[model samples]
Target: MPKFAANLSLMYNEYEFLDRFAAAARDGFTAVEFLFPYGFIAGEIKARLRDSELTQVLFNCPPGDWAAGERGIASLPGREEEFKRSIERALGYAQVLGNTRLHVMAGLLQYGQDRGRHLEVYLHNLAYAAQQAAAHGVTVLIEPINTRDMPGYLLNTQEEAHAICREVGAPNLKVQFDLYHCQIVEGDVAMTMRRDIAGIGHMQIAGVPERNEPDTGELHYPYLFGLMDELGYDGWVGCEYRPKAGTSEGLGWFRKVMSNKY
Candidate 1:
């Protein structure tokens, strides 16, 4: 069976931000992930996780500025030093939370920048980040965001992501294979995962097109999850989707899926 985790950032809007853990726990989630927990103190968050008995499956390294339209800069040129600092900061939080995975968002590219040069910068930064994460027993994940949802995003395909991971050649560096984005950019989910599963360190899902609860969309998650089972994937599959009605209502679908045979 595939272990499911909830992305607290996207799931709960009913409670105050700091109270999300209690809400997620009430919803029956044993593990959770978030985009960026920069505002809260790491120690406080760790305490809450401990009290709640929730495992931190994954969390993102802080991307420079979201409001300024910057998704991440970990792979951008001229920002190597900034990117390293971001990784270190995330490591600090990960250590406290007992998190084993960190998602590296390969930010957006600046205008007039050569793609090749940017990729080279990303390669070097990733290698360095991987080394740092390895020392802390954390795996660094590189995600390929679909341009349709996030225009001008740096990485957008599993093929490119897989190639980058291979080039990086670090045990701690791997792809965060997000099923929703992959389904949007490229179908044939099972085959693609099978081909690149070796490089995958984490996984996430939302229904394609709508980005809502998995049961509300066209992707047959039963089969997709079945494929994951047959592949013997042992990583957490995060539910990173928007709730159609509410977090609790959306959770019913997850329960139904979990109860059924994949």
Candidate 2:
């Protein structure tokens, strides 16, 4: 089985953010990921991870003004400075938490906005972020979010994200391939994973259509898990899904898969 990392951002909502680390650890998760750690001091989160004996695998850079409806500012024009600041802030947290991966969310595009301009800005920002992150031995990730859930999200396809990585020309910059989003935008999730595994820094999974637990949706996750093992993907597979019921109660699929591996 691929190494599974519980995504505290979407899972384990039953507990407070700080408490989710121990909750995930208690449930047999050796690694964990979250959306942002900016809300809490880095030391606070680091302590939780140490106490729980869990590894921090991934977390996103600041998505500017998340409460104000901003998904990210990396691809937005006129926010280059803020985007750079977000990367700096995220790197600080990553260093403290001992996480090597930092996801950079491409903010949404507004009505009638020029996508060409946004792409230019995004490429430049990613290059800068990657260069800075490399010095700390951290990898920068860009995820292709499905527009269905995030209508205006700037990045929406694996091809697009990979192309952006190529344009950025930074070795540390890679794709955060979310299988759930890939299924929505482009259906051949397995083939995409096999073909692009080299450029992929991390991955996330959820059931398609409902974005629920992997076992409850259209995607056949068992096969995908096997495929990850076959393809020699050594990165952490983030369980970024909304539990159909309670987080712990809905982990039967995870338990079964892990048992099979053992």
Candidate 3:
């Protein structure tokens, strides 16, 4: 069975950020992931993970100014320095937290912007990140987000992400196959998984349309979980979704799955 990582950024919002670690562990999550760790000191979060005995699976590099609506700055022009600085900061946290995977978000495209230039910058920046992260035994991941939820997002499909990975020519760089985004941009999530399994470093899932619990969505997650086992994918599958009701109440599917696993 695929190991599931509770996404604290979206789930368990009832508790404060630091307190969510224990909450997730109490609910049977052996591992956890979140959007960003910059808000708190690395040692503080590390202590929580240690206390909870939960593994830190993944987190993103800073995405420029998140509050100002910047998703990421790797693909944006004139922000290369800021992007590099973000990577350095993230690596410091990863070292302290014992995290090995880092998701690098590709920023949105502006109207009338040069697509080719953005691609160039993206490739260049990702290559740098891969080189730097490799020294720490970390793998840098790039995810193809759906344009519907994140309008103008630079990357949008699995093919595009894998192609970028190939062009970057860095072995440490891989794709974060977010099934939610894949379903929105293109159906055939299973087929895509099979085709790109080799390059996938991590996976994420959420319900389509509503982006709620997987059991509440059109996609049958049970089958997907089985498929991951059949394909020999041993990476953590991030539960990156919003809870329809309370976070704990919405975990019926997860609890059932865990019950069956043991």
Highest lDDT scorer: 3
Better of 1 and 3 by lDDT: 3
User: Against the unseen true structure, what C-alpha lDDT does each candidate score?
Assistant: 0.88, 0.94, 0.95
Give lDDT tens digits, candidate 1, residues 1-262: 7888889888897877778888888877889999888899998888888888899889999898888888988767778888989988999999988989999888887667688888888899999999999999999999998888888788999999989988999988999999999988898888999999888999999987899988777788888888888888999999999888888977766777767833
Q: On TM-score, who's better, 1 or 3?
A: 3
> Model 3, range 1-262, lDDT digits (tens) per residue?
7899999999999999999999999999999999999999999999999999999999999998899999999999899999899999999999999989999999999889999999999999999999999999999999999988999999999999999999999999999999999999999999999999999999999998799999977898989999999999999999999999999998999988988752
Candidate 1 lDDT at 179 equals: 94
Clashes of each: 1, 0, 0
| Model 3: CA > 4 A from native | none
Candidate 2, residues 1-262, lDDT tens digits: the string is: 6999999999999999999999999999999999999889999999999999999999999998989999999999999999888889999999999999999999999999999999999999999999999999999999999988999999999998999999889999999999999999999999999999999999999999998999987899889988999999999999999998899999999889888942
Off by over 4 Å in 1: none
Q: Assess the local accuracy of residue 244 in candidate 1 as a C-alpha lDDT between 0 and 100.
A: 88
lDDT of 3: 0.95
Whose lDDT is higher: candidate 1's or candidate 2's? 2
Q: What TM-score goes with each of the models?
A: 0.97, 0.98, 0.98
